[model samples]
Target: MAATISPSSPNYHASISNTTINNLFDDSLTEIFCKLPCKSLFTCKSVSKRWLTLISNPNFHSLFLTHQHTLFQKTQALGEDLDQPSFILKPYNALVITPNSPSLQLGPLENHLSLSFLGPNFEPTNIVPQLRSVLKFVFACSNGLLVYGNPRPRHRCIYHIRNPLTKDSLELPCALTLCDHAGVLVGFTCDPYYHLETDKTKNAKVSIFSASQRRFRVVRIPAFSDTRSAFDVEVFYSETGKWKNFLVSCPKGFACGFFLTASSVEHEGKLYFMGGGRVLVYDPYENERVASVIELPRGFGEAYRGCLGVSCGTLQLSEFPISPSSAFEAYSGRVWELKHCGKGEETTTTTTTWELVHEFCLPEVVGPGFEELKANESENVKGCSRILAFHPYVRDTVFLKFGDNIICCNLLTRRFKVSKYGGLSLLFYPVIPIVIPWWPTPIPALPL
Candidate 1:
């Protein structure tokens, strides 16, 4: 027979006091707090003075940051199964932020850097300290460097590159002469590499800002012309810092009108882009001469419009299949594979092959469901019908419309993850709300 202890007994206080809360080593306390979900950490902060001091320490703050990033990656991987709409008809104009605490609210997007959040019903109290600006452009972020720019055309079009985390900003002098060109378009990207002998520190390269001094730097390809029947010319990233020139050189008399949508997929040690009826691959260090271009799958040119004018679609690369040898590539309209093949006699070739994996149609466009939803909204939702694409770097593909909601399709399992949100114009510029993933690294050679 054993004696039982009750909370009402005087011995309860003895038991509690005997086991000192402060006696728990710092490492043990940290491990326990780290294991708790982000929501619980907030509640635990108020539990005791010891916990409050432990949680508020800088070391713990760093741990929480790492945990938050890991959670984001995991959540993004599972986003395909979220409860999204069958057809996202409305445009998502609002910025979404994901914080460490689930109960924390997302603040407004006015003059502030908005990090993406994982929960619904955003609140205002949960905004982070570093992100407080109406971010204009995120050039590149890698390691700890984040580059961003705001085109102040009225005052010489200044481009600002800054790391929000470190609060380090480099204002690059305008690369172009204001007198020569009427307008300029600034773009940024990063390339990750692996060196056998060197440590990982030297592996990644990023192109934050480039200036066109004398001539307008345009992607040049031979046997291509500016004709209406031909595919339009666009720039793409093959390596971290290099841009590949793609010319939509359709056959001479093929009466095909091509619209261009561009997106990048990182596989193995290279980054590939799909656009204008062709897939282009680039290796940053090894292959420096030219990018290898492969023709799109049969009938891809005829299925849908090539691209959404000048507004390039999103690109997401994921480590799937649970093997280091396997990866998945996704674009706005399609998903494919970046396969490594044996080296031939003269050349070592890596090919980008499309499998025609998934095809999706918006629910609002297919039925009267959109009309009923629109009628029920507050004040008439005034927006045109258009297609929006999202590649969340994990699961399958998602397509949204200006008035329709969000719809995701799994590439490997061939299933639909249901979630819905109203859509907006397809022609609107996409807001890449997060910080640029790479910056301050050497610029990779652009494809010639």
Candidate 2:
């Protein structure tokens, strides 16, 4: 018996083995690679030409992104715990803003202080000018992407949506360039439902390069005041590349007076902004230009500042009462839960109200002396704190900023822990739920 040999080499007999290897590298390999964490996938891109092409393919990226989303949602639904969210300190100077490798100080529980740094491996080509101008502000973040911009006078500001994970960013034109008003508040939110298609088998390739499919929408709510009650609402939809304007009339008692000083909270597909004495809930998904106003409990006067937050799927508002007597002292704080009372009749909208759920003094909960701060300084550092953000996955917990320190407090257990670092003007924890791999990979490191 004789075997046929190819003209190029005598290895023609290995055809059967070669065919098996080729078949194994086909779709099955792609399926496994799609499930790899983004950092690992980035490393896997250099394995081989075939591997690089497969990972870089638009279809493959779409599949991977959707798979990651599905995994996050499933884990979130299962009530799993994740690491404490990291904070990005507000840039104190142009140098701080331009640094590629920035130190992320962690406020992990206990008096422990740990320091980790993000690599200077990314190029700031898209946001260099804005970052250098001292006008850049990170208005909002979703998942791991950030919405930031250079705000200018005459109602003009250049905006950008960025993803630190991928070192990519998209610049947006000034939507309010023509206006002559001040105190305009801008916010950002990412809706994957509207951004990405769940069924990757259908028209998914086009979504890979779609900016709108990858980013969030920019919302600009007019600053209503005592004299002006009506204004145009401008919303920019990333996918459509168009701005939709809606003229909204505030109810007699409801207006976003002094909204510039108060921040807006996004929960369950709505934006909550503080008004004079009530909170205005805006449903950007709704067609009408109307926003529902929820009044605060009686005696929670307009002078008291409010921070909006969401915990355990409930809208929580914390009030900080400032008084001259306690201007240099710590005072008691209050947390209120907003309850949806009843479905409105056919002709009316949904009815909502609030109830006070918890109360605690700032000094007592944070302890008389924080380990991070000096004993002498702790006594001098006495003032009410402002709520920064709530722990995304934890229950009944919120982060507060007092003087130069950041503290995490649990309302249910009445416990508090302070971050060891100071001089942080703003803080943000990247929203990706899983702990990304760090060694030899570009995935950002976390301070354990």
Candidate 3:
């Protein structure tokens, strides 16, 4: 009976164990698959039925996420050489038409899609289809997720919450109340406690799903006040699937003009909005109805453009110095960190003070000035280097726009690198890679 095996029979090869990945034990297979990047794991899913099942298993995802966290912990303990933060750049533009005559026949401009990232390796990975037809513009980034919406008017617009790493996107129905209102501003925040509630080991690696439903909070506020220094605000809660409305009043005499592209930063559960001369702070989660405004630290002029961000558990301001400089670039980088002068959670926003933390010149950061800009400084003023974005999490890092290049600088380390993304209306956000792919079991239905 032992000698009766035939080459044509499927069982004939069963006794001869093949040492391929598919034949490895479940525990061994998970260890190898978990090491691959999100995109690579997507590719490996198609290798075989066994692999697809194992990779798609809930248990596998939990283990992979645990492993990623462990690696991150180790990197953090080891310091700079290992756990440096990462960044991603995405460009956007609006569809403009004649203000007076809607039918003037000025067609839409060509849209360009360019995405690049600077990670621990410093090498940029080019993702495909840089131009996504559905992605009109990105409004905010919370954790590793992004909230993007269509360029169409409020009535016709739709918003999408996406995880760029997993390529899982959720298209949400338009929030007419939030979108239809003029001067409305949108912001996103990632719940720090989101992971604790959702970290069950049963269904971790479900593969394709948006991160929004799992752990994201989106808030909407009016930029300008109908009343003096006060605005109405609304919040979208993922857990309950509802929007909550509230009001925020800025300190007396504080005036802010939020541009179409102005962005807000969320730090320690509070949102900081940049105004003409002060930073408006909104504590959405707190019971407070009024916002507290902080004036620019003394010696920091209000004439120049400024951006707000949170880094190292403190709020920061990065100002583009409009002061006269001999360099061809009109603006030099200026950074400041907000320090709390008083204690207690009640006085956190109102009692904070700012201190100059870092500053760098364009020429020193970007190496050499562009050839054309060098020819004539005043002539190239329109295209002068400017601060584009901040490292949302880290205050010391800032992104600069010098002509066509996007420069990334780490103020603490004094290290700068020019980004490889090329597109109009450019912006960037930072992300830390992990292998947890969350796929919602009951597909979320879109509003009609």
lDDT of 1 by residue, 1-448 (tens): 9587799998988987788656778898897776665335656879888888987665675555444445544655664343321221122232222232322222232223332221232121212341112122332233223334333334333344444422445444443333111222223334321111222574532122223211112121212222333332323333322234343433422222222122233333443444344545444434434455556556543313332211123333221111212211111234333334567788766544444444533332234454554454433333322233433333454343333333344444445443444333223333222312211122334334
Model 3 per-residue lDDT tens digits across residues 135-203: 225666655466665433244345566655445667664564633433445677655312422336764
Which sections of candidate 3 miss by over 4 Å? 1-19, 45-136, 151-157, 178-182, 192-215, 225-229, 250-256, 302-304, 324-329, 342-350, 366-382, 392-395, 425-448
Superposition TM-score, candidate 3 onto the true structure: 0.66
* Model 2 regions lying over 4 Å from their true place: 1-37, 46-83, 90-136, 178-181, 193-216, 227-229, 258-261, 301-304, 321-329, 344-348, 368-384, 424-448
RMSD of each: 13.2, 9.9, 11.2
- Tens digits of per-residue lDDT for model 2 on 144-187? 44566544445466667655444556767667544333455556
Model 1 lDDT, full chain set: 0.36
Measured against the true structure, the TM-scores of the candidates, in listed sequence, are 0.47, 0.65, 0.66
Which candidate has the top score in lDDT?
3
Pairwise TM-score winner, candidates 2 and 3? 3
**lDDT measured at residue 219 in model 1 versus the true structure, 0 to 100:** 25
**lDDT accuracy of residue 447 in candidate 3:** 34
